[model samples]
Target: MWRAEESKEAYEELKKKLMEGLRENEKIESILKALKLFNSRKDRIFKEVDDLEELREKIRRAKEEVIENLDEYIEKAVKKMEENLCKVYLAKDAEEARRIVRGIVGDAKLVVKSKSNACREIGIVDYLESQGIKVVETDLADRVVQLLGEEECHPVVPAIHISKEKWSEAFSKETGRDVPPDAQAITDASREGVRRAIMSAEVGITGANAIVAETGTIITVENEGNISLVSRVPPKHIVIAGINKIVPTLEDGLNIAEATTLFGTGQRFGAYVSFITGPSRTVDVGLETTIGLHGAQEVHVVLIDNGRRDAIRDGMKEMLYCLNCGSCLASCPIYMSIGEKYSCGYFGGIGLSFGAYIFGAQRAFVDGLGFCTDCGACSEKCPAKISSNDLVREIRRRAWERFGLLLPPHKKIRDAILETGNPFGEPPEKRGEWMKSN
Candidate 1:
């Protein structure tokens, strides 16, 4: 949505941030540690799978089928969820999604939320705060970033930039106590406050890692216990997720979740894997089921289309296969250098593809597409086998076409392509000259 000048300025600012990150030893160390963990876990997964290639093929087929049948699956999901006592809303865009959530959360004073990238994309927290609602982030990493007023540098670990020493200081300031510079101490301090907030909050919100259409379930994968608390404690539970997250069946959703966890942080499985069908209910009384007996009395699932349907229609169908594992970010030299400080919406090479639609070409260009090396490292590590480097190059080509700002070398290449049907500048008649000479 940024103008040309604004986009250009954003690009320059991103370059500055990259340089700053390169100079920060602590940040570099953190990235290296994450990379190490990722590699080790990847090796384990490769060894654990009995048929690696078969699994990849199955997953690829499954994802393709789901995307192709997205509309049908969504309809089924809505019906099944409603039958389970969960209200469903289809949001056409970020603004509409936010408005729908606002209407559902009307007059609620306090809300607790888990780490959901969808929430960030829709700007829900800021909008809610503007309307005088208090929202607390339950994820420890999310809490750290929220307290410091910084964006998440990584999908799984929001506070990757914060060192233990600095994090302890922040926690101490937040808690008004001299918290020790230890991981446990900081976590304990945050947990104590968040626990109270969760219990007293009027509503809880989360993002779905995947949705099962047949079972009408929302699947969330997390390493922390925060999401469990966030989804259960409040009287109302809301899930906001992109339409692309829907799968045909619960098994398919689990497969995606497993791959996401393995690739996301090198974990064999997430510490917490939650599947919510609807409001918590019990069939203990005379074999008759009662809704909202223990957990949230009301459940709402807002499936957001936003720019995803447009993206699929506009020839970016493969981009929707993204699992949001953050593996591409870990593998991308550009992402590792600059972090996600400049990405308009999501982060990493896959983020560039989504950005082109969700944030516009100008913003996507400024986000990091111009600086990509096109080495295909990201695609190699991607769980879904998305060619992120190729996507970035295509976006760049589109940018060049629309903007009409060609460097001299690019102009020459364009001229050659137009003249010879290739960038080599060879005439059609001379196509076989090289073979003859050889």
Candidate 2:
């Protein structure tokens, strides 16, 4: 489904997915259940914030400062990381990123990966698999999605649509036995599977929460504790991140962590937060330095730009301010009906913004650019407060400008309005003509 440019195949596939998601389905019920749980407790989560606007504003401004000066920050961060003995590369796009990672892999059989939206964004799993490299997902939800042959529905909870029975089925296939469809049983099985994969893998891959350019620190936040294991157990760790993840300081990274949990999971913070700088090292034995004592011996960070640079150049910088939080989708009416299939690569109006730039404006139309109602719920719930609705509308306008195919449905409505004074094409007269019904 991933291509350097727009493809007819991608459009048709996404259109089919859009129709499937719109119908009544168990995934819709499951998504509704998850959103209900999230909605019920979000008030308590936000109530703890002493100065809500101040916190949001501060975080936004700090990130905006870095994004505005991303080139400088990336340069400084790359220098610092290289000084810390980590291999670094600036990948101009997804293909270059895949090529760099493939070179690092060099025929390695197993690569264990933690939860990473960036990895999904660039389609690394399929790429590696095509090269005969077996990539195992150490994260439980990601494992389930892989087993089910499904893509993520939400950023925080990728397997929200999966039920306990489905979980057992997904794992039972791997075990070749009848595992019980119970929560504890599923968790135990998944944990064992991930442990085995991590223990045997030669390389580990991860996405970033934020990168502190001042100290060359890469921060990853999670609750499952798999990120630490995946990043450490393997001899080599490879990190793929968007350039937008760069921040000026560790304090900024920590703020991003807080915002991620607050908006995504209604928590003040996640249970496990990992700040990795360079490879593992020690200097304890006779004051002699050694590396790879209990963690990765080598670390590689790939800073991927894709279309982000062009997006900024075209005045679409707000699209990069997303935290990948699913808060907006929880309230998105279109998302409620269609789940993640509404958008091509990701979930809601905000996701459409990213898809538009990365996939192209014409493909964005097929990715459900017209589905958004400009409700503004996304902006209200967004921690970054990036007017995603407005951005999506702007992308739709661009789609129309580029292809002139985005307005046929709207043209029909317009014609109906002009002829009958109603969008529904109902017959109409002057103002007093409707009194007959009463």
User: Best candidate per lDDT, number?
Assistant: 2
Q: For model 1, how does the per-residue alpha-carbon lDDT over 1-438 read when each residue is reduced to its tens digit? A: 334455456556657766776676667678667777788878887788776566556667777887898888888889999998999999998999999999999889999999998999899999999999999999999998888786678888878778888778878998899998898899899888799999999999999988888899999998888888888889999999999888887887888878888778877789889999999998889989887766888999999988998878877778888888888877777777666643668887788888888877766765666667888998877778889888778777877777643334556798999989989899999888999987
Please identify model 2 stretches exceeding 4 Å from their true place: 1-18, 286-288, 413-438
Taking all chains together, the TM-score of candidate 1 against the true structure is 0.89
Clashing pairs in 2: none
lDDT of each: 0.83, 0.85
lDDT of 2 by residue, 1-438 (tens): 234234445455666777898774988999999988887777787988887677678679877998899889999999888988889999988899999999998868999998887888789999999989999988888899999897778888989888899999998988778879998888888887789889999999999999889999999999999999989999999999999998898888888888888888788889999999989998899898799989899999999998899889988898888888788988899999898877757679988888887777766777788889998888887888888899998887776666654445575797788988988787855555668668
Distance from true position, residue 211, model 2, in Å?
0.4
Query: Estimated TM-score per prediction?
Result: 0.89, 0.91
- After TM-score superposition, the amount by which residue 322's alpha carbon in candidate 2 deviates from its true location, in angstroms, is 0.8
Worst 10-residue lDDT window, candidate 1: 402-411
